[model samples]
Target: MTTSSGSSSHVTDARGPLHTGPGDQHIYYGDIRASASSDRSGRDPRQVAVEELRALRRRFVDPVGSDRARELLEDKRAVMLTAGRGHGARTAAKVFLCQLPQGSRRFRELVDQAEEGDSAGRALDREQVERGAALLLDLSTVSSRRYETFMAELPWFLKVVRECDAWLAVVLPALWRAGFEHVFRGLVVRLERPDPAAVLQAHLRDVGIHVRRAEVAVPELEHELTTATMAQTADLSEDIRAARENAPPGSGFAAWLKTALAARAPGAQDVEAHLSGLDSGAQRALLLTTALLHGARTDTVHEAAARLARAAELPEVATPLLHHRTLTARLAEIKAAAHRGRVRFTVAGYDAGVRRWFWDNYPQLRGPLADWLRTAPGFTALERADRLELVTRFAHERLRTGPPDGLAALAERWSGPSASPEELTMAARALGEGVVHARYGSHFRQQLYRWAQDTALPGHRAHVVIGVCSEVLSRRFPDQAMIRLRHVSRHREQGVRVTAREALARITDSDDRLYRSLLKRLAPGEEPRGLRDLGIFLHVADPARMAGDATVGALLADHWTAALAHLPPRRWEQPLRAWLERAHTRPVARRPALRALATACARQRAAFGAVYAAACSWAAGDPARRRTVNALWEAAGSVPRPQPSRTAAAAR
Candidate 1:
């Protein structure tokens, strides 16, 4: 019953010959024979069987039948016995049989053939006979359990299997398919049966096969292990090798046994149960081991760390395993990998234990700290103090070595509300460097503004940054420096306010154009506080000579009018004296500024009359001021008086 297609196309039954397909072939395992030319044209029957098995698995629960199907079953049986444990295959076979049409004649014929082929040197090939035995054990029905009928079918298959050393390998898969643990227990029961050899001898005698020797001697069985003699008789080595080779990822007897005994942790419950059973010391050791190998990044490892932390009552034990040289040294390679950014974990305050462990070793693990600061999750979970500490440390480290390329951005990030004094200083220094040295200074200008608005930054620290900025800007960015100093002057700290004001004064005094520029930016009624003092220094403090300068006089009149109006009457004498003396002694060409000063002073006649009179006397000798003096006198006299109140009229 073979064909060139490599699948069995024909089978003989009471109905005579049946053709399965165009090119099917049948293989006889017990007797090796050369096939006809036509039968040899296609693939090997074993390979075809493997392909069909894979196809069946892919189909998942498809019905299977036909002579070719029977042939493929034989192929599975052969491979399962020799190269694989029958567990996976037997399970698959049961499912496949369950899916077959119930009353299909072809399937029934295959079942009958499987039964008849069970005897030694029977009508079927040895492989076919083995498949028949597996089929019978896996035959499930509503009336009887699959394994309950194993004894009834045993007599038939026992004839062929008794001669084979691999009988256990062949039969175990069938039993395993029925129930994983029950099969192993059943083997132990059979082995421990009193005079098991005699029981088999009786069965053989009933079949008219005289057994001269007790070749089937049962060995004592222990609950833990099958006896060595029984193992040898069953050829356990072949079964073990076969199981390993052919077991699917999560199937097979070993996998089933592991599942049954909870050997491997398949989930959290299993893991928890196992740890629960350990002694306190063992549990601690397990936690330490987990911490050593798995950081808190993964949920499982984090859970393990949490469990250990809960069990630890003392601070010493609560310390993470990474702090222990005994554990950490062994994981140096993993640490190296983590440092290279190949692995990611956050030691932030998301978990107290993780935080303590990470920070303790942060110095050694700083290689990835910058990247983590930039990208790791849970950074915000760190407490404000810890964040400040880490950010400051990183900023200083960056500044010292000259930040790695493109890493200056991290320094800017630290200049926030939570920024420590050290961190704010670093941020300011970075900004100063960018302004003075980096080509991308403007790019960070907005960042500086943002930092400026961080009101939570300590006053002293903010003052320091303001100082750095003012100094840098005075030289390199005088215009911006003026604005920044003006803003900082309004701060709540008197020292900071004074520092900014002084900085503005120095900047204004050093550069006249900058002084004028600063004045121009001040709105008429709203003079900047930083420059309020500057107006006095320039216009009123040394006013005697300053009045003689047109620029100084105009600046005073335009923006510092209120400052001018508020200047003490006593302080006005010096500028007026200097103006009059200059008019009297110097040439007329310079007198316009003095005259302008006189007009501005006359406008403030209520406050400046006495200083104006002193100036009039000093200017009396100057030819240009003869009219100027009379004009000043008249201007002073024409000052309007305040209106009386209605209450005053009632009193009258």
Candidate 2:
């Protein structure tokens, strides 16, 4: 295609921006214009983002290395240089941003160990930590909100935000150092007396921090130093802490509340005294929160409730704890914390304390925790809503889990409000529907096992069967229900594997007594009847010979119909495989049965019923058994006897 321009045509220069081809789906903007120049190579867009991020860090960085911010710049620069692609760069940035807020924690730890002369490093480190933390907060908000239009390019945003976080760290600490609170102090002075005692007392007076003992007033004229003078001194922190504790709530108001409290709120100790003085429910709520803050972990209903009761008297607050204003506030905060998706109790001791303290503060959170745990994987299977309530209460109230303890802190949380067994059954049914529910049931069953201390074979078998069945149903037919589960009868304390004598008795009962005199000599456990046990009675009745019976073939054919009528054929295979693997003696019955079932299913592909499977699985495993069955069929002229010999039908 060629075009000739007339005299009125537009003029163009040699260096004119040429129109490149329109971009495909990757352009992100949906714009027709391409980002690449006419002579550009098809390099990755993420690379461009990384380069831009590096450039941004350089823009904020000061070269003198004197501005502690250089450290931040260096960190961000390293990420960009290492992150060559978009995802790499973006992920790095996201992680850094997430980790930045934690930097303050690092700073605080350093400050604790930091010595006298390393002041510069402490100050610098402090700046870095706080900035990192702030940056992380911002990045989390932005990334969560997805701020960029060409958002497919994550590396660019990551690099930019990471650098921003580093810079913020450097800047924030400096802002604090720049008399952020002293500025407030100056304003307080202008507004009122700037009296440390008065200001501190005012903030704490109505709040829970009361004067356990008032300090002897130091004469103002005698000391010569005001709140400002003491604040400026290097030992001000130590003095402020002592004063906050001993000189009344407001004694060290200017220094303590403004500086120290800004970094770490002083509540646990202050409110704790009042907590002990409150009624049981209130005290329990508080202690639970405190425990959580200290990194305590507990889930047993009995244990948690007991701990709460032991730590704080619940009986005292039974009447008014529900209505207390402080309790209400504390519950609201803990709920908010849980919603934030960071309910981990991992701090050395603070998390545990916080957890127990929080529960003590609010008795109502018991409902929410129960509801939450009900939806949690293993916990959901709890048969009783009240059981869930008990469990959550226990976790919040009395548990102490962390590096400090390896034991499950047991304590009863619900001597007052336990649910009925019917409620538990309903809960169990709902919870048992999912894999998560199965896990919860397993946990609950284990608890039962522990209590019974009866690891007897029969008891163990019952538990194992239930667990295995639940797992298979959950994993294989995720959406299926356990309909028609009329009863769950558990076997008593029998040994693990079935004994020969018992097997004989079981088989005798399982035999089709239609020709009672015919099989009078049959083993007790090896019943050949298809209808008496619904296929399960004969399941293990015969230890030596039941499975070898020729009737098993016809029996399977008959029972397959009922099995299909209950569970759809699509899901039958898993249960069948499970039964074979667990109940059958073959080395790898489950996998082989599964393979055989799959092969049998190849033809039907979509259609399924009981007869089809029975035929396919009629005689599997031993080739000799298959030959004998064929010979037997021929010998009887295709007439199957009521029951065949066990040895004759061995595995082919």
Candidate 3:
């Protein structure tokens, strides 16, 4: 920097004349590969000059008394980073460090003006600012003293920590370990003390970044959580999980329910009510998404999509409210479109499914349906339906190639009242044998068994299912008949063979195919008997298994007295008693005959209570039984009980 001061600060071309280079310039260190483009001249320097001065002060100033010197270096670093490059970078830098007398307003003005000039984009250039910003970090790094000063100037220095990935080999460790505390805690610690490498190693250990002591390997982890969950980290899934789990008691997601309730959340009983009640598909979609953020499941989103899909296929939904009946009035329009191969177009506003339903049923919609199918988007989407329908249709077509499954037994389920027991038995056996080789599903077999439990009568409509060779399974195995009559009489008696459940247990359980096929032919509500009944009939055939009538005290209502007279006192005792006690007890109590039947051989206790209740009541009528009855009665306050003897005494 000195032009003539030879003794103190000399600039007199003092390089050792290595054979006297041609010009005044000789390679200073034998390293003249290229001249630095940033070689400075006398141009108006940027406010970054202060940055250079600060760096100079830090390098030359005494370490023990260098507080302001460090602060100036920090401000300079911020300038070089945020400001742009310019001429006179070196000389302006040296001039900035020139010592000045105290009480001088001019020096302070220069500092403030330089900062304001950099702020105004007049000195610190934009591109240079960004390049300089690359060096920013809270912890020390491997860089020149000047570059370190540049990094110190940034305000929100940690922003670079997140947005800049390449810097993580050093800075991220500091940020992670101490949460940026290293900058303040390590303030008094001079850069020469611990040094960059030592600072980095210690930071890595403190932050738990798992760095090898000397290795420079950088690791990038995958982000498991969404952006909303990430504050400043890519692999913070563990942190998020912990936070969610230990949310403050009485104040986390559980408490959200109370908050939602306090606000009178719509349909607290049914979360989906908002989505379901919406007439518009778009509105429902909005609600569905909101519910998701509120912790609704993915299935709820899928369901909303499906609802819109189905609604879009309905005429009532697809048509504008004002134009709902337009399809009917535009009959000629429909015909013209059909003539032009545009039938589908005429039905454009109507839901294709609704049109098809009308055409398939009322015949009037046939015209519209045909016209629409020719041109509407319905046929376009129908191509996709082809794949779904293929398997079902294949199963149906295969069925027709052979005999119908379980036709014989299934025929009995659909038989008329005139069908004789022999005819029914033959039909049932044939149907049973037919299904032995059929590919009947378990669900179908269960249904068939249920049907077997029911008796179909003549002149009554009983729905039967038929397989189609055309449509898919849904349509192929169509439920036939408008109604299925379920007469309880056919299955009333136990026999050698019966419904699937009542069939041989060990035998049927092993033959899953037979069990399932049989179930399919059965109607709902009628169920199979258990393994016990089946075992008794197949393995033992005990008389007890075949036994019917259960004993009960006889009771003749006056309404059926004439019919009752025809019986020999035991015709109705069995089932009526079985039904009264739910067939639970062995023998229905005699109810002490309301005086031992000495007065009227009738159900005298019936006047006051049911068979069990009356019998119990009658027992209670005895002084001996009353004690037990009273004890029980007092224990179960207001409990209801009936004792026949007691009732009879009261009646008397």
Candidates' RMSD to native: 41.3, 28.2, 41.7
Give me the runs in candidate 1 sitting further than 4 Å from their true place.
1-425, 436-439, 450-458, 524-552, 566-597, 609-652
Best by TM-score: 1
Clashes of each: 10, 93, 48
Model 3 stretches astray by more than 4 angstroms = 1-401, 405-417, 434-438, 441-456, 459-613, 616-652
Which lDDT tens digits does candidate 3 get at residues 265-328? 1222233332245565434332322221122223332333344334434322455668643422
Span of 10 residues, lowest total lDDT, candidate 3:
467-476
lDDT tens string, model 2, 497-532? 122112222212212221121122122222322121
Candidate 3: deviation at residue 171, Å?
Answer: 57
State the lDDT of candidate 1 residue by residue for 1-652, as single tens digits. Answer: 1111111122221111111112112112001111110122333322233243443334232122223333433332221211032113333343343233320111111121222223342222333232112232322211234234443444455456444321222223223343333223323211111222333333334434344443332232122122233222223323333444545785654443233222111334433444455544433433342333332223333333333443433243555766644423322322211333222322211122333334343344444445444432232233323333333344434443443333456554544556554445444444555543322444444444544544444554455446555555444344555655655555555555555555565545433334444554443222444234433233322222232244544554432233346555454455455544444443532345444444555555565656556656766677766655665556445534322111100000
TM-score of each: 0.29, 0.23, 0.17
Worst 10 residues of 2 by lDDT: 478-487
Best by lDDT: 1
Q: Sort the candidates on TM-score, descending order.
A: 1, 2, 3
